[model samples]
Target: MSTATPQKFEFQAEIKQLLDIVIHSLYTEKEIFVRELVSNASDALEKLRHLQLTEKDVHDDNLPLEIAITTDDKAKTVTIQDFGLGMTREELIQNLGTIAHSGSKQFLKALGESGAKNSNLIGQFGVGFYSAFMVAKSVKVYSHSWRKDAPGHVWSSDGSGSYEIEEVDGQRRGAKIVVELKDECAEFAQDWKLKEILTRYSAFVGFPITLNGEKITTVQALWLRNKSEIKDEEYTEFYKFQAHAHDAPRYRLHFNADAPLTINALVFVPQENTEKLGFARLEPSVALYCRKVLIDAQPKDLLPEWLRFLKGVIDSEDLPLNISRETMQDKALLDKLGKVITKRFLKLLEEESAQRADAYNEFYAQFGIFLKEGAALDFTHKDQLVKLLRWESSLTEKGKTTSLADYVSRLKDGQKEIYYLVAPNREAIESGPYLEGFKARNLEVLFCYEAVDEYVFNNVREFDGKKFLSADHSDVKLEDVPQQGEALSEADVKDLTKWLKDALGAQVAEVKSSDRLVGSPALATNADKFASPMMRRMMKAMKKPGEADEPVKVNLEINPRHAVIKKLHALRAADADKAELVAEQLLDNALIAAGLLEDPSRMVARLNKLLESV
Candidate 1:
């Protein structure tokens, strides 16, 4: 202890209000105190680094530029020491005691004038040091100024109303904060617990970090480095460390941009989609950083919701954070960053698709749902997202995929629309009546198998100026297949169609002799222009129990050359009773093929009745 007089002061009214808010409601997580103190320590070290470059002398020139944290659970205390710029007796009074010198007066005044409008100014004040009271019963800061003549001092506070500063002897060249943990916060005094928090929130801090004399932040902040200089192994290690993932990254984008905003991003596409494995919905994992110091580990708006699968670090020097450094304050700036990152990732995907087809295909196989989502919902990048979409079409092999661009390349000379059909699988699609006309005309129909594909296509509507049409839609018009064999005469078909419509009654909107069906006797096409079989299923699944099923109205088209239609037509001319049963059976069969049959039991009973009659 030194024989110097002590200085004591009460906190300003604004600081008292600010402190009350910080202690009660500012940070949702109590663990943020570690990040706040570490950041302050880092700033102090940075000040000393700058001082050495410009000033004539720095006290203790041989001290290492690092931060060390020690924990003593038995003593219920944790201490964080740094060997950088330290505070003198006067600084201990000014920096820790009086609010007039703490740079928070301007921040409070700004907040008072702007009311709720200027909350973004909180981060510029550097008041993160005051967050220590959230978990501490009391805090003692011991520091020695970098100036040779300045005496060391200790600042003590319980964070209730006032603080004390006194001269101290034999202090080192940096600040050491000793926190007496409250009973509820005693977990922070354990070595393992402190290490975990440090790893999560402060791992990439520019200065070295150590716990209990062991270094913790071993990996470099690769996002800030030159992309070419980073090694493959380094990237893999960083990915595993940052994402807590086991498998290596399948793809990564390390880039820096300056124009829209200063951005340094290192994003990685994981080897697999965790959400695809039945895990809970993934939260945003891209950590936000400023000058290599973490601002947030899971920022909600850093990227679009469709990009939740990505994991890595994004360091933006332009981010304006709140005083807690836990959330972003500027929504517009965050949106701009999101746009830039999203566009870059999309451009990378395009290049990957061109350069590594097999790898890109594998990625699409696992995570294509997100791209489809972006295509449907993100208008600004809908065209790019659509380009990345893959599908199995008539031109591609069974398991292979094709893009819209490839589909366009294979289009017939005069084709004006892109056609697709939604079904359970390729086999179901091939056996359906909708594909017969397109197949006979040598036209390719893209197969959409996912439940959401219908919704996606409806929102996307068109791509490359070509409208997307559902092959099973009632309004789809196909050119007549060239004459192949003897067919029913026009008068015979006209009579047969009128009689069929009367027999089907309310089941169908229209009955006609089909030009679209090749081999099928009859097919049901949905009358609802916007709804497909898959969309109907989705709506039904989402409906509440006992809700009435949506009415299924379809257009029934008959193929004149098919054996079943010929038999039904001749039977109708002779036995009217049996012919009615055959006509109903034919309509049920068409409904089954169209996946519009809500009750298969009725179809089963009708089939048995027909069998008994035969």
Candidate 2:
């Protein structure tokens, strides 16, 4: 130690400016000071570790590279110590008293320009240390250089305008910072408070960390580890910790990519979708990290909203963070990073569906809505998401599902469209009149039961070069199947259709003998190509009750060979009133089957009149 008076120096203009910005306006949370100081310590230790490799004459070579934190509530002070590359008197003045000579700033510029993926270096801005002044009344740095010939020094500052530095004795070859907390900021000196901050932001730091002599950084950074080296239990444990979940994850995707952006991601699909259980909407749980230090825990723009069900960590070295690291600086680069993660996740789902059909089906049963949402919304990843969609089909058992790729592979020769039908359930679809034609022709039709099914198909439109066609759509033209039983004459068929159109009035858009009806007497198809029956019903339900519905008109298609049509043909002239009543009843029945019937009052009265006539 030097037996001399302490040398006081005026603070550099830039250092004063930097302190004001950091303490007053830069950080959103005052607790961020803990993360910044700990990060700086870790960076110092990393530098020392590197020096150990090449330098033979190192000071304090036997001290372990670790960080220790102590909090004294009675004294209202917090002390953080690290056995790292401490600074000499001149270096301290350059690094702390002046912003221009900051060591971390130069390292950041050099690392960035070199495009190096040094995961260990996190101190990009050299001013992270000044964040302590946010909650500090005073800060003292006790440091000794790693060089054997250098003497120890202590720098003191109240962060007002100037600082004093003087030599000290018996100092270790590292830096120890003691922050005398302000009266209002005494919370930082509590054991529990510091523990919470350290676990959240510094749990994944490379070096060991202790809070009041107890190890707090116990959770490993599994995302940066090799996937093959990780075990199922380890991944499950990480999922539970990261997601704050009770149940094990249903699926986990751990991968690293260098292209497009250097990424280390570990994403998981939860055991169930809480949103589906009628809970509040889910938020994005996939936290964004850089170099193993968390940047944003719930970054909204990190993933698409539909993928809110996923939970995990995504750490990338390529992110360009602003000075505070509270938010990302480059939104375009952030978007690219998200796309990379999303594409990888969708690919994982595809692989799961192909290799583990039963398990994947179970996952789909719970999480399929997310995929459907992505398919219907996100255009960039829609093509990949479409391959993961599943639905029940006529060719599969009641509970079994088929993928679009599987359906396309099974398509009949020369077919150019994939057909689907939305109904209340499998039984409703199988028994409905619309499916009779497809079943009769031995063609498969996907059965969709969810309310969003129609909307999804409407947006997806096509897949694998084949257009999506609703089985009951008015524009649908199915190839003819062999006719069975006696058929009505063409003249009689024309007469019945014409009478039906006139007798039903505005209820019928057009009446025609059907090519798409078999084993069923008749069916109704939407006249508006854009509005399917299910979609119209959904829209109508969303409106206030008793709100008059928009006028609905459907094209009624009748099977000419069915006995009811033949009898109607004979009875139309025999009794015109009875025939008119029967025609109205037939239209009502078709509307009910199509899910387009808004009111049945007129049909109820007409039905009673027909019964009395009988």
Candidate 3:
């Protein structure tokens, strides 16, 4: 009798193209191949785990269900073996030799037809097995079916064009992938490299991953576990491991959602905000996962950029497991997932701020810029994010913060606007002429220190029907203060105002007797309708050419009752030139107080002239 063997077959045309993409351009990092193979092994073990729950006649049930990776640097080969549900000879031929059975054919067809410029689809398409060819010169997969009656088999392929499946003896119940590493790719066979890759990409995998006989995935997938079961210490450890942060988490949210999407998330706000230390704006560090398998370590669009300070894991089971499993096939679903998580996170923050004021304040001080950013840019959740913002206000002591809701609650019965002033510090704002009028009227003004606060407030025009108005805005009209100590007669005020306007010329848009100035001699208001001191500084910092010396007109308001202005009016009539110099000096001093002076060099020279006259 002639012993004839089954025939080997060449790869399909689409499979060849798919292989080329997988081996060359599919994944940004080549180390992902280890993660892919380990993930596949974990899935096989998971299947057996489910099978063990119901099935009684399981083959080799005595063997522990785990993935073991053995590397041989000398031989330039790495073997990933899993003692779980293996495949029969026919199953091997169908799963490895053919493209249709592996479900990769449809993915490749989609890739070719869609012509999507970004190839983030490869990992999500379920062809992660082919990622082996990225570093392997040749691969041999030895598998045996879990059925006691099924025979063992070996599938060998160089991934050039063809593959062979032959019956092999003494194979284990699960699959084992043996990759002969290319000359330049042998670093994967080193124990240290494999362990690092496993820790980074697959540390939280449900199944145990062993590298060179030592288990590497010691940390559990806390996001997948019941929140009640996870201890605080475990959470801290996970945060440290995932976020690479030294300090413990200031706040954490462990939540699961089923309606919008099946999501399991464990998110953390670190104890310190690194960006607050003037580090670069943080990129989104939330690791994206599907069923405990990592999809993207840092997905740019997974969450809004404002939530970049958040660190942790988000896992969704609804995600389709594609070939590479590095990205998602359905973008709409991913976006929905992102929105759901973001909303839930925002809700959690609201709760934290309410329940733990001191802790929340610490977190807010470090990470509040992100909330301000969201308020300015992310329109979908702007209202909710705005509510979470806290600022130093006249109602609160220095370094203390009050929320917009609190600010609204403290508003007087007839107050129509929410007032805020952007300044360098609380002391600066308190000592400025703008706050004097507000303080006289007992009106609260929010103190903003960050440059972005002005932009944020502009975008958030109103909150809860109260318009946000800058305290220093020229358009602000304040209640008239009854003459308390002294008064400038209507004629004297009119004469002084006329003389000041003529003396200041174009530098003063319209000098007038002030209703807002309390003790100060004068105050400068921005003449440009759309620009404030903060806005001007932001524009200058952006280095828009020819913008530094951009002329900004100002409306100067002089306190008619102040001694300096009263004496200056008399000095102007007696000595016109000296009064003009004194008037100019007073205007420049107000501009400096308003943070509107672009160049102080001229002010210093003018001061020297005044000193000589003195």
Candidate 4:
């Protein structure tokens, strides 16, 4: 029955070291061992399939090309069996007991050189059979090579630096690895647990996986299929299954790229932004896969941080991964992949915005904040992100929005800058003094309602060679508009400004006659080149109390043509104290309108004094 007694062999030093790492430190999760083993099984099966295509006289030529996994809790063993290519006795010794499959010596040198996790590099080296040691008290591999003349063999090891290879008979077509679970690792021997692992990491594998004789992987990898052959209903079903949601996807990008890198990506935008509905921020949802096996479900840097809401799969055949296949070894290659995906997504957004206006508006209303975040922080994509940004403007109808490209389309001759104002809402901005200057000069002012919008514009700085200027910034100097009514004289304007500056003291950086205002009495403008009052308030809210806030100084622009300014100029000489009180009240009113005033106590007290004086 037996050709010989089991031959014992001591592991090479590098093999021992690798075994130690596998059992002790290689994987972050012991469940990952399931993924690694299944991956190796899949590889073996793939090899057999290729051999069948070219070679004749292959053994078990008609065996089903699939993987079967069984768990026996009573026996405390987990078995992964594949009906593909197997190995002979000499093959088992070389592929398992020695350093051949492991590239053991070079791998240890790589770990030392990187001084960090490089499973991405390890993946390039090869899959380890030693991963069985991670959870096994003892392991046995029963294999029969694809060659008809090759004899079956069993490789057994306790993972204590030595293993035994013995000739065996009646073994089937491929390899079957049985791992007896260690005491603490017994959970892996349960059918339910093995099924869960398979569903997560191996569900998209090229072959069907039968867990305990029941097929578990039923969904095909939709991303890998051709778009022309796929149906709309099929896409929606895949979206529902992959995203675990009942709602249909708002948008789906199924694309394949070759230049720069080979990529197959299928990304979806959910119908609703959960974060917009007051849920916690989403984690990165684009799962990364190599061939068909998952590398990471939520690769943090797979896409820019702003794309956390994207759902689907990204598979690259070119990834150079480490042995564990858990991490990427080449950081530059990873970054290039991310950039390619991001650029393609932006292009998709641009197309949708142009061709599907209503659908895009709905998507943007829910998830535009993320685009704003990208415009602000992801400098590489900022220009593209800025072009996709939309906002309600002074020129648009009440609730309607316009894009930077559209806004620039209507730019008047020699209009060298794009002006915007940050306020709480459209009504607040339209009814406020900031719009008066832009309206009188026939210039459009974009209405930025969200606090994040200001930060976005500040980071974007310019679009289409036009600098973004805040309508209320002291630096803004619009063309003077002609006045129809009698206005205060130059001398009186100068006197009133000097008196108002003295009355307001440190509160007003300077008081000057307005060149832009048409209706409003006055306006307060922040002296900071880019920081709006609302932006400062937002910053202050995020900072600790003891943190130093940037000092604020503002300019007061008094409309010379306004009746209140005329009355105040004369009233100052007739009643200095009353005029001074009115000036202080006016200054406080302007500051409040600008979203600059923090505590209203002084303004409230001064109002009572002004009413008494009246």
Candidate 5:
């Protein structure tokens, strides 16, 4: 058998292109080649072990089911051997020498479409065995089939488009891939370097992997076992090992679902949000896996971008297991997986909030902004995300927060709107004029402290039949409270508004007596039927191109009950221009309170002019 001449075959054109990329551009990190070779070895071993149970007699049946590695730094070689199902002569030709027979053409087409970015998709394709060529000058595979009748073979390749398969006698079951390292890849032959790669990527392999005489893969695949059987310390240890995190998990969701897809997810919320402390924005660290092998270490689309703060593993057998993220051939399937996982995570948060209030609150305190972001951006999960939002309301004391559910529960019988005010802090919202009417009407207003709240509420629209209404909005009309010390007749109020409108000119859309204002002299309301004044200002700040620079035309709503209006009615009659300054000053102050004031320089000069008159 050793004298049998080698039969040679050329790789298909597309396979040649794939080989070139694998050797040059497919992987950014050279260490990954070690992972790919070992993963393939493990798969072969698993296949043979499965065959052993079904068949009464097997070739080399008693050989230990494990992977062994040996390094020869002086000889510049590394060998990975597995006692698993090996290849017969025909099997070697089909597996190692032929690519057109495999699905390599389709794989190459996908690579061309996605370009170089998604090389991470390689492992999913089951073609990872080729990755060894990246670090190798030449490769030789020695194998024997699990079938006692089958003869062993050796496949040799230099990755120059062709491979040779020859009969080799006295071969044990499974394959041993020997890589003669390229001059530049000599480091892979070092015992310490090879061990590091094996430990980092292949540590949890179901079968034991030994580097020389020392074992590297010792950690059990905890994600596959029942959660009840696992100890807390074990989970913590696995998380630390998987996520490379120093702090223990703040929250963990380890669940197995059979519906929609077969999934085993171990998701964790970190003990602290690093981004909240001014660190770099967290990348999508949730490593995706299939069975026990990793798919993508950080798949950006596996979960929504807003979930970047989470760290864990989501292993789904239902996933296609072999496709680029950008051109996920089964996009609908992937989307279904994403939706299911996101829904589960949201449900987990809801459960925590209900059963473990303080802990959930702590998590919300650190990660609430991400939830708000998802609410504003991901319409698919908008309604669910909105329910998850938490903030202090005008009725709640400092640091105390209420959810939309709680706010909606307390709404009055006829209250047709869910009121909210976006302010910098609790002090700002309380001191601002917007809350006065809501407070007087005994209606609860959600106090939104984040800058993005304005954008979020505008899109959230409503909850439970109550339309979202910003307390600062101009069109708000609260039920009138008992009039307090007001002496302005309707006729006097009409004349004052008409004159003020003429004086303010283009700045005022329509000046009228306010129904929403309780104590303020005047308030600026948005004239745009669709966008509020605050919305317009936000749009402007975003530097939306081609938008008009025309000043925001606001309807000036004046409170007839306020002492300032009572004085303003006489002041206008006594001194016209002096009254004009006070009118503009009152409008500017109202604008400032509404969080719409931009250029305050003119307001300062006008205030000084009013001071000179006094």
Candidate 6:
């Protein structure tokens, strides 16, 4: 009920400028107005809570500390009311008429200067309230001051240039904002739309919130709560609610840190990796929040790209957000926060691997590719990510894995390089010529079965001071092992290599007698120092059709002690034509074993020719 004639006043010049930005460009999403208003409501509620501790005389003392949002499609209006610290007529003018006089901005400045009073109020720039003009055709604020002596007032604005204020009676203790939405933005007046925006941005606000008399904020901000008091079932429920997950998480990291930056994080590793199930690339699921209000639901810069599979919440009180709160103003601070989180997660993994080996192994089996991705691309956390990677080696039985640190621990005396072989599977590696020499010399070779393994190792390069060396690489030189059988003389080997080199021409980069071959007569290794055989095959596969591929040339290493090499050495002089066909067929066979043969047409023809000579 109005008690006096309305007094109209022109908006302060700075506020008019700010209103234009808020209405036209300050925010990318128009629905952000709801988030801004709700945050302000939360802040007001917090102030009233503090006032209750000191002041005995207050208006609307019986009102609960909560927020109520009501939307009416028929009227095309949204009403949001908070029973918190309301404003007097002069306070309203000071807080709303001028941009610089924002109570929240002053509070923030005081917090900055006084070293953080124990408050979680999030309105920092004081410009959030103006965001309502984005959708509102007319706005009205009804407020009653907390002091019993102060009178209630209603402020009205069309956000054009001027506004009116009227003294009113029977007003509540806090503020109630009614937004008469524009015709084009009438969708915001729907209950469903408002509910969605509220649930997304304000679900975890400290105070209770209700929409049309029904409770909206049911889930607590579990990340901010102490971990010791949280039960496992509560965690599972929160995970299900936040992640929209059906299966319980395999691992969860809940931690709070104060140094460098204040952070509260709850991250989860799902029981299954959906990206591995042939789904589209996972988007960043770890939402970014400030003081429990969502800043970005899928903030690309909050976490490294490799952590896209992780799903949960990361809330920080230390964020310095812009007026709109859509983006962070300081990228360096965000990066520091991300680093802290990544390191903490890796530490959790380390502890899990040490204390619960079986569970960690199971998690690794499901999500190891993501760690490999991080190890390859994210240099800042690569060392920690590398330590968390797991692989099955020659010494380990199938289905069992060992970490890079464990492999380093078991390094043979005088072993200077960590050896690994990339193949399609353990069976392919065990049956191939690459592992024969290492196995015979009692050296362990890690079995890498994924396509990304070689690329990851290439990027990682080394771990624990030992460089990673591919077993099938051309330049790899293994220490001398005592011979078990008769071998070709040095002179005989030189002659055979010269003849084979000439016979194979451009196909063979070089031909030499090998110390790294035990049973196989010959094997092909890529002569290119930059790319492995597997990497070359992958590159060829990815190349566009009709694009010419570079010729495949390999260094052919022949086992001098094998009967096939000795027979080929003799046959070259006896039957020149037959020896040429045998040599070509041998190179094809080696290429097939290395998974480098894209077409076997020439090999098929040469096999028939060899059969005819026999």
Can you write out model 1's per-residue Cα lDDT over 361-426, one digit (the tens) per residue? 999998999999888888889989999999999778899999999888888888888999999899
Best by lDDT: 6
- lDDT for every model? 0.84, 0.86, 0.83, 0.85, 0.80, 0.87
Q: What is candidate 4's lDDT per residue for 1-614, written digit by digit as tens?
A: 45769999998878888888877887788898888888888888888889888998888888899999999999999999998888887778777767675566666776766534333333321346677788899999988999899888888999998989988878888999999999999999988898888889987778878988999865788888899999989999989888998988988999998877879999999988899899999999999998778889989977999999999999987876656677576788888999998998999999999999888888899999999999999989988998888999989997789999999999999899999988888888888888887887789999988988878877888899999988899889887667767889999999899989999898888999988788878989988755587778777889997998766689999988899889999898899888888898888788888888877998898889888876
lDDT per residue as tens, model 5, 1-614: 57589988897676687788777776767777788777778877777777777898888878999999999999999999998877777777666656633445556766555332233344332377777888888999988888899888888999988988888888888888899999999999999999888876777688988888887757887778998899999989988887888878998888899996888888888888888899998999888776667667788777888999888888876665333221345666767888888999999998988898888889999999899889989999998898888989988889889998999889898888988877778888888777777788788988887767877877888888788877766668778777667558999999999988888888878889877677677777667634554466566778767866657667778888889988888998788888899889888987787666778999989988987877
The residue-by-residue lDDT of candidate 6 on 19-83, one tens digit each, is 77668876999999999999999988998899899988888798999999999999999999999
Q: For residues 1-614, what per-residue lDDT tens digits would candidate 3 score against the true structure?
A: 11236458787777788888888777878888998888778878888899889988777889898889999999999999998888887777666666656666767665655423223332332367888999999998988878888877778899999987777778879999999999999999999998888877787777777788787856788887898898999999989989998878988989988886788999998877787788887889998987777788898888998999889999877775456676556677778888998998999888888999898888888888889999999999998999999999997888899999999999987888999998889888988899998888889999999889988988999999999998887888888767565768899999888888998888888988878888899999877745688788777778866655567788989898888988997897798988888998999899888888878898898889888888
Q: Which segments of model 3 are wrong by more than 4 Å?
A: 1-7, 12-14, 112-126, 544-548
Q: Model 3 misses residue 316 by how many Å?
A: 1.2
- Model 6 residue 210 lDDT? 92
- Tell me the tens digit of each residue's lDDT in model 2 across 538-595: 7787989789878887899999999888888889889988888878878878888888
Off by over 4 Å in 4: 1-3, 101-106, 112-126, 546-552
Q: Estimate each model's TM-score.
A: 0.94, 0.92, 0.93, 0.94, 0.86, 0.95
Worst 10 residues of 6 by lDDT: 112-121
Error of 5 at 4 (Å): 6.2
Residue 354, candidate 2: how far off, in angstroms? 2.5
Model 2 regions more than 4 Å off: 1-3, 103-121, 541-548
Report the CA-based lDDT of candidate 3 relative to the real structure.
Answer: 0.83
